[model samples]
Target: MLVVSTGDLMMFGISAVALIVLAYVIQKTRLGRALRAVSFDRDTAQLMGIDSTRIIQLAFVISGILAGIAGVFLGIKYTLYPTLGSLVVKGFIASVIGGLGSLTGAVIGALLLGILETLLLAALGSGYSTIAVFAVMLVFLLIRPQGIAGSNVQEKA
Candidate 1:
């Protein structure tokens, strides 16, 4: 029997709410549109009368805020150490598995990675599971470099 603590439940709730809010903001807000436009093409956004500089600054600020919140959550979950950033490799792999530029894909990839890693750990051992994760990532890259949700983009001549 698996018992979950209230703290874990609260953390999960907070994470879910944050993701939902961010998705809503990016999908439905004017600032989000401006951000997207600037990201797609700064020069074009400028030509369209969008202040690319301001939007870029706002984006930096928002990213910093989100990073800070994530750091806090991580700290709450684990001991803080300089080597903690090494774990980001898993995140990068998850993003690659889901496909770059697709938020939904990234989330799904992360969940899938977590499930797979957990199963591997249970069946094998920690060391082997870690190696297997890297192996799986390599296989994905070799076979489907665009990722599960990423579409192949054609460059304009």
Candidate 2:
């Protein structure tokens, strides 16, 4: 494929979008709330009549469907290597670095990372791209540990 002979960023970009939509659904729906409740307190949600196992199943199904779509892009991006996800590790890290457990945070982080990656790869070179993004994340972590829009809200006392 052209991507293997040449590192193709288009594949990553498309796959990122597909996955983000799936992630958004997971974040916005009532099912999503049930899952979040289970996550926040499994016993409490169960007491409130939410079935945790069913929610977990839904999560797995959602993840699998998204991963399958991503696989197509990966298949195009790189060869049939065992470590298919490795190529996009930095992107995933960016999603987390922007804000784990925060969907908007992850998205904003991903876009910024993409822009940063593009600019640095253009100006400095791909060799320094990783370092630049990591540096930015490190600085953010040292400063606003709560991440962008991360509420400092603790559970009700």
Query: Which candidate wins on lDDT?
Result: 1
Candidate 2 CA-lDDT value: 0.74
Residue-wise C-alpha lDDT for candidate 2, range 80-99, written one tens digit per residue: 97765565777666655667
- What is the TM-score (0 to 1) of candidate 2? 0.73
Q: lDDT (CA) for every model shown?
A: 0.87, 0.74
Per-candidate RMSD, Å: 2.0, 4.9
Residue 133 accuracy (lDDT) in model 2: 76
Candidate 1, poorest ten consecutive residues by summed lDDT? 148-157
TM-score of each: 0.90, 0.73
Give a tens-digit lDDT track for model 1, residues 13-50: 98888888888878899998998888777889999999
Q: Show model 2 residue runs off by greater than 4 Å.
A: 1-24, 82-84, 152-157
